[model samples]
Target: MNINLTLIGQSITFLAFVWFCWRFVWPPLLGVMQEREQKIASGLEEAERASKDLELARRKAAEQLKEAKEQAAEIIDGANKRANQIIEEAKNAAEAEGDRLKAAAKAEIEQEVNRAKEQLRSRVATLAVAGAEKILSVNIDAQAHDDLIEKLAAEL
Candidate 1:
């Protein structure tokens, strides 16, 4: 091809090309690329922060689990001690009550036996006097009957 080289035409073409690139291509394209790069950088930073937060949460959970285990052990120990104390106190109280009941029953039985013996003695004395009177066909004197009752009571 034959060369067509002119300074003015070359300068005009270069100016038009530069104008087109500045107006239609360079501004929006460079702006979009820069915005995309900034967004990627922000996303990477957010991911790193989230990872740190997760580690912190895991550590806090481990501490809470340990504290909970200690509290549970203390509660169980306290319950066991309280149960033992209650059992001991109950046993002592039951023994005391049994002893008191046993003593009361023994006293009542002794009193009842004494009362029965007294009643039987009185009845036997009355029957013996009645038989003696029937056999003799005579009424006994009051003073003699009283003396006989006294003797029988003393012997019993």
Candidate 2:
């Protein structure tokens, strides 16, 4: 065998193999690689979008939470104010009731005192008529002497 012929044959075989791969095999392989690269790029873009959406959702949730807290604080403050108003109203009502009771008690006391004074005046007039009758040695008719007793009670 000649060395140059062997070298030439191997060179031609290598060229033929490279040409075959380029024409029949490389196209499908390149296409598959391009499809894989597009899928990867789309997946990366979708991941980035999902991450942004998650961030937006988190921010929105935080804002809502803050608003809820503010609303709750307002509600609590309103409740406190209402409670204070209710308490003040109750206190005012109680005070008014106390004043009314005191006035009623004062009126009742005055009525009782006036009743006692009338009774005492009647008793004193009766006693004075009895003493006058005893001193004059005459029995007094109360119904006939009613006007004198009235005058005497008035004087006392």
Candidate 1: worst 10 consecutive residues by lDDT?
Answer: 127-136
Q: For residues 44-91, what per-residue lDDT tens digits would candidate 2 score against the true structure?
A: 999999999999999999999999999999999999999999999999
Query: What residue runs in model 1 are displaced by over 4 Å at the alpha carbon?
Result: 1-5, 120-155
RMSD of each: 4.9, 5.4
lDDT of 1: 0.88
The number of clashing residue pairs in each candidate reads 0, 0
Structural similarity to truth (TM-score) of each candidate:
0.70, 0.73
Instruction: Locate the minimum summed-lDDT window of 10 residues in model 2.
Output: 135-144
Flag regions of model 2 displaced more than 4 Å. 1-24, 138-156
Model 1 C-alpha lDDT per residue in residues 1-156, reported as the tens digit of each score: 555767778899999999999999999999999999999999999999999999999999999999999999999999999999999999999999999999999999999998888888778777776766774587667787677767766877
After TM-score superposition, the amount by which residue 5's alpha carbon in candidate 1 deviates from its true location, in angstroms, is 5.2
